[model samples]
Target: MSIQLYGLCETHSSEECNFYCRVCMFALCKECKKQHDIFEHEIIRAYKVNEVASFRLADLESLRDASDICPYKGNGRLVEVIYKRGDGIACCHGQGNVVECESCQYRLKSPSAKYCSIQCKVEAVMKMNESESVTNEAKRKVETISEESASDVKSFTKRPRE
Candidate 1:
């Protein structure tokens, strides 16, 4: 009905341990524990991050996929940290002026490359021309209908009692 001693120090062989080192998982006696505490207490607890150097594409890929902190070591030298932002440079693109394709979201390689492929560009132009033709035809029909209605109204105004 009494508590038992599960931890015993190896140094003393028969001494009951009072402290446990979780990092190394070692049981220590009072004297050894006090020594470790004295040295550990002298060490600093907080650390700071200096500016990071240039980071490679591979490094950023891992950071994005894993959602982990920068893996750079030694003053953060492996790569520069770039926080993703809406108004900042895009994720897949470099620092250059580019436009999006009218039909799809693909970024145009150049100003001349309006769409992602030739098919898209051609299709867009054809759609524009077809819409223009339809609009013109509709306008002509409206004008003709208005002219005929005006003539009918004039004839009614000139008619005698009938």
Candidate 2:
């Protein structure tokens, strides 16, 4: 594409912008391009941005590296955006941090997963069953004792019948 002046550069008011910085999302002139180059910024011709099929100004700014502070206390860890779909929602987590399984306390396969594996889920179910059975057994014993006590009390009270 032929080099054309897009507009007056925002940084340098006197010079016209011929290039754009993909990282900073700013239009820059030849003089300003030199400063952007120091940081290895992606500088492209201003007109060519529209020609690129995948170039979207909004997407470029939203996909920047994460710099937000982490929520977990005492570690001062910083969370990073792991993935983002077209829906604009982001799945973020601290670097090297992992979610644990609700049942086994082992590292989970994924953030949304409840148990680490099928075995952990099965074990948790089995434990719940065992506890329920024990509780039922105790209730049965209490009922049996209560019935026996009632029968004995009736016999003793009805004594001396003529």
Candidate 3:
């Protein structure tokens, strides 16, 4: 009496059907059956079904309690960009005399004027003339009062009472 093995294929033979090995779970042809049986017969061991079920249940519980939020989220802080050495102008947030151009909005290092272009420098100076005039007038008024007060004090100190 011979038992027929179902789904055994050998290279395009319609009489042979493909089947997976019970041990290694690899598809085997009729010619490869002997090679799979040699390895499978040695490693046939019974496993506890209850232990496998408990392990899978623990994995599912841990996955359910796991956090979805990222730990590194919003951790980066804003940093100020520093200018190169000998650039004469400090950074935009630093104590530098350099500024952006009002007309073109270009950032440039300037010691005397806030603008990089000659036209912008000239315009800035002209626009600032009114404030300069007011400052000069205030300084002159203070100097006049100081001088008059000094002379009055000197004259009073020099006079002798009758």
Which is the leading candidate under TM-score?
Answer: 2
Best by lDDT: 2
- Residue lDDT tens for model 1, 117-136: 32344356679989999999
TM-score of each: 0.33, 0.34, 0.30
- Candidate 1 shows a clash count of 3
Compared with the true structure, what per-residue lDDT tens digits does model 3 show for residues 1-162? 011123445553554423334345344454555556665332211111322100112222333211211111111421111111123333365545555555344464443323433334334556789889999999999999999999999999989888
**lDDT, candidates in the order shown:** 0.45, 0.49, 0.39
**Local distance difference test, candidate 3:** 0.39
lDDT measured at residue 99 in model 3 versus the true structure, 0 to 100: 55
Q: Which 10 successive residues of model 3 have the least lDDT summed?
A: 65-74
Flag regions of model 3 displaced more than 4 Å: 1-99, 103-117, 160-162
Residue 32, candidate 3: Cα error in Å is 99
Q: Alpha carbon lDDT of residue 142, candidate 2?
A: 100
lDDT comparing candidate 1 with the true structure: 0.45
Best first by TM-score, ranked:
2, 1, 3
